[model samples]
Each structure stands twice: as C-alpha cells, then as structure tokens.
Target: MHRLPPYRLRRSARAKYLRLLIRPEGIEVVAPDGLPESTVLAFVRQHSGWAQAKLAELQARLAKLRQGQAERFPAEGGSVPLEGRETPLFIEETGGSRIRVSLEDRGLRLILPRACGAERDRYVRDALFGWMKRRLPGRVAECVQRHGPQHGLYPRQLRIKSMRTRWGSCGPANDVNLNWLLGLAPPSVLEYVVVHELCHIRHRNHSRDFWELVSAHLPDWRQERQWLKTHGGGLIQRFDPVFP
Candidate 1:
C-alpha cells in the first residue's frame, strides 16, 4: 500500500467535513473536531493521488518563484514582459504633480513628481493597474466579438476581475469573467482564455464537445494553455507587495 506523505492535521471547531489545503507552506488537513485520527488518515489516504499531484504543482511553483520568473516590483531600469516581449521600464521624475505613463519604442515610461515620497510604490502599482484596466476591456471585447460570432457563441456580458484560481469563467447566463492579470500574458494566450470562456457559453462543462468547439476556433490553444500553465502563476503573484 502507498503511504501518504507527511501533513499537518488540525481540528476545526466549526465542525465541517474534511478539507485539505495545499499551499506554498505545506499541506494542511482540516477535519471536524471530534473526527477520529484514523478517519482523517483514511481520508488523506483516499485522496493521496490528488494530494501528491497538488504537492508537485506547488513545488514547481515555488521553484519558479525562487527563479524569479516575473518582476514583482519594477524599478527605473528594470524590465517587465509585455505582449510576449521583455519591455524595459523607464522611470523619470518630472516637476509636474500628476503621474503620466506612456509606451515607447523600447518599453514603458513613467513620469512622476520629483517630490513623490513614500507613496511611490502605491502610485506606480496603481498607475500600471489603472492602465491595464483601461486597456484590457477593449481587447477582451474585441476577442469575444471576433471569435464568438464564428462559433455562434455569444456572451451577454464581459467582466474583468483579479481572479485567484481561474483565468476566466463562463456563467450560465452567458457572462464571461476574465482575470485582469491576463493582460500580462501574450496576446495569443489572452485570446485563448477568452475563446475558452466563450466556448463555455455553448457547453458549460469541459466535455469533449466543449474542447472541440475551442479547437475549432483556436487550433493553437494547447500551446497557449501550456504557456499559461507555465507562466500564469508568476503573473498572478505580481500583485504581492515587493517593498513591504
């Protein structure tokens, strides 16, 4: 018999069924307060396959983090990947009070007040996120409009959010919700996610028919999917504070 790996077990007073959390720290097993240790062990054993897979995934993520796969906080001379390329970031202090950002031939340029103080990091993050908010909506709308019609799949609405666990989701009402962080990925990758959710409008489940619809629209979707699987975590982690 295969033995389960070492994990920390905890008893919750709220009294719920067994819940397992695989995090960067480690695996945690949460069970009802009165549940027998043997039962908890049995539960872990029952889900050993899933637990092992999740552990491997998390370990890979941690390894990527250690390798610095993405830039958390970009400085004046630093560069960030934008639209499939490593775009340089140029930060300059201007005498004006307002902060301005623009895309140049080499990369992105930001102009901030010379007297900008402790709030610089927040200002930069906000400026970048605001720029993405303004830009991504139109891009997503264009993708949906362009591809949705071809497949006879139309979504009633489109929403952008900072999703933690998913790139995008399609609701039963034909609403497509996309992760704003996708703007950091290559254009093809973003398009794949949009097409994926749009296909869900036709088939809500991940059945064979659903994937067939996706491939019909985006034949290179598997490559894009692999790109996200390899790079998505770094993009999602970009929101974490680098200074603090």
Candidate 2:
C-alpha cells in the first residue's frame, strides 16, 4: 500500500452537475449555478475524508480490473470456461502472430507465437471484437423482432461499441446500441440484454412501463440482470487492455 499524499484542491467550473471530483491529478470543485466560492471551499474542507476514501476505493477497483485483464484469457496451463465445463489453455509456438483456436476434450487449445507479448494481446483482443461484430447483429435482431412486434417498435439501425458504464442503450426514434462485450457472456445472458434494450424502443426509461415490457419477453430478467452485474466484470478482459 502507498502512503496518502497531501493534495492541493483547485476550483474548476468544467463539471456539469457533479458536486466534486477527486481524480489522481487533483480535486476539482465543480461550480454549481450560483454557488459561492467560499461555500464550495468550506464544503471541500469538511468532506476531505470522504474524498480520500473515494480515491482509495477507485484505486483498489483499478487494480482489480487490471488483474482481471491480465488473466482474462488463459496462459500456459491456465483454465477458462466453455459452456459450463472447465477447460485448459495450451499455447503452441506458431510461426507467426496469428492465434488459432481449437476446442477439444482437453478444453481449448490456443496457438500462440513464440514471441508472445503485448502484440499477441492485441491480436486476441481484435479477434474477440471481430467475432462479436459478426455474431451480435443477428441475435439482437432476433430479440427485436420477437418483442418489437407487440409494441409496434421497430429499430432503424443496430450498432456495437465498447461502452464504459452502459450495458445497452435505446436512442430516440428506435435506434439501438449494444455493447460489444456481450460476446463474452453466455447465450442466455446475451439474449436477455438484447431483449432489455429492444424493450426500450417502446419505453425509453427504466420506469415500470419499461420493465413490464422487458418482463413480457423475459420473465426471468431480474436474474439475468443480476448475473451481468456480478459476473460481467469477469468477462471484461482485453488483450490490449484500456481503462478510463
């Protein structure tokens, strides 16, 4: 553990509605409409303890996320899940940088380059993204078609992007966005998420109406949602890991 360092707080007006931001750079006080400088300073002084704790929590979470990224896929003798079974990862010395994956009774064997390192990580990440892009649209469309008919909700377009905090989003006038990370989850969980977003086409918010719509398609939505929140982070490993 590192010792806590003394911090110099600065007042900044760039924050939209957040009251305080305690980034590693420094503390930034978001100037709310009509809030006096003295009041904001006083608030900062009183809540210094809370800010430090929040910073500590963020640091710990970052460490955990990084650890997860490093171990996302299996290394030599490492194990990952296929369907519900445990499988071992075997690395072979392939001539080039390409990864060739094969699943067998021994689990999954991933052929790696003799010089595997950061470059190899990037290759795996790109491969995962490509697989997701190719497969997600049809699954998303299936969920949309099954549920959209009931509410006269039809989507104009469907796209996949890496999102920081959102699972999926429903834009105005029936545009839908899904997180590419959906590929890492199980088929049932992925289907649940797709249906959840499609329901938003009819009802935009997480209000009762929106939930009712989701429930109509997936009666066990709450279970799936909980699974995503608890285990979803496990699926969040990247070969070329990036964090914000």
Candidate 3:
C-alpha cells in the first residue's frame, strides 16, 4: 500500500469514531478515546489514497504560488512597494567605505562604495534590508501600544528582524518578533500582523477560542492573511538574492 503523507494521530474524547482530516499542518487522525495505536494506524491505512491525493493537490497549489511569485521580484533600480506605495530605486557609486540607503523626495537613494557586479548587488540588498530593520521598531512601537491594551496582552519585548519563512512569532516568554519586510507592506497589513502576534500572547494555540479572539479584533484577518500568502513570497525572494 502507498504510504500517506506525514500525519499524527490524536485521541479526542469528542470523537465518536476514527476520522481523517486534512489541514494546512498535515493529516490529523482523530480517534475515539481509548483507541489503540494499532487501530489508529489501520484506520489511516485505509484512507491513504484520499490523503495522498489531497497532499498532491497541495503540492500543485504551492508550485503555482511559487510560479506567480517569481514574476513579481523587483529588479534593481526598479520600483518596489514601500509603505504601500511603489517607490523607485536609484543607485550611485561614491568614494568611501560607507554604504547607505536613503529615502529622498524622488525615491530611494542608495549610496555604495566602489563595488561591481555581484558585490554591488550584495551591498544594495543588504543596505536596503538593514535600513528596513532600523526603520521598523519605531513604526511598530506605536502599533503595539495601540492594540495591546485593548486585548490586555502586552509583550515584554518587541523585535523586528528578517525571518525567511515566518511573518511573526510570539514566544512563550512574552516577546513578539515581527518580520522586517512588513515595513514594505501596507499599513493595514502591518496592523494585522501586529494584532495577530499580540493575540498569540494570550492564546498559544490556534484553537477555536484563539480564532474567536482574532476575529473579534480584525474581522478581515483572512483577507490580509491571503494577501500575505500571495504577495509576501515575492518580497521574500527579493530580499534573498542568489550570489555566485
């Protein structure tokens, strides 16, 4: 028999019988309380065909998303979305070891020391990314204070950094980590991310109660989340350029 995708068996008291559910995380097998491990495996084996088909669909969807993302990467000296606007980029080489990215009246002004080809690209990428990080803490501090009190959740510390695969994460220690790329997204998107992480401070898991809390604050969170899934990939690839 063909094996199923990665799955975990859960014993739920509310489960009347063994049932297989496909979720974003993976396949979940909910068995009635006191079901033996062997019985759960047998139940999963019977649904292998169904689970494999579903996961293959997921793979196809992911591949399509990546293909769409590839078409959106911003080229150097090209425009990129900054603060919800398509900001132009300008690069200039000057004599010095100083590398800086500045926002001028026209667009972003990148000052690079004598560098060429791949080296130049690296400097441009790093300077823009570093500038974004430095600019994020102040941008988000007000947001945290604005939303934290209403929900009664306050993070002990707030940090903004580059996380390739995550938008934000709330640690158990009451520290919230927001992605630096969020500074490029619209203010609404940034606000949504802040609220999401703040909610995590109270609800560690995405149970029904957790989602209710999220919905209460941001009724349109699903829309913002979908936007991230579709457009966020391009931003990620833009920051992570291949150098050889």
What total of clashing residue pairs does each candidate reach? 0, 0, 0
Candidate closer to the true structure by TM-score (higher is better), 1 or 2: 1
Q: Which stretches of candidate 1 lie over 4 Å from their true place?
A: 1-70, 94-97, 113-116, 239-244
Q: What are the per-residue Cα lDDT tens digits for candidate 2 across 157-223?
A: 8998777577788788677788777755666777787888777777778899889888888899998
For residues 1-244, write the lDDT of model 3, one tens digit per residue: 5665679888899999899887756788899999888998887888888897897788788888866544444445577678768898888888878888889999988888875545776677778788988888887888888877887988889988778888999998989999888988888889889888889998998898888888888899899898899889877777655555
Ranking according to lDDT, highest score first: 1, 3, 2
In model 2, the worst 10-residue window by lDDT is 235-244
TM per candidate comes to: 0.64, 0.59, 0.67
State residue 192's C-alpha deviation in candidate 3, in Å: 1.0
Best by TM-score: 3
Runs in model 3 with CA error above 4 Å?
A: 1-76, 242-244
How far off is residue 67 in model 1, in Å? 7.9
lDDT values for all models: 0.83, 0.68, 0.82
Alpha-carbon deviation at 210 in model 2, angstroms: 0.9
Q: Can you give the lDDT of residue 30 in candidate 1? A: 92
Give per-residue CA lDDT, model 1, range 131-154, as digits (tens): 777779999988978897796888
Candidate 1, poorest ten consecutive residues by summed lDDT: 235-244
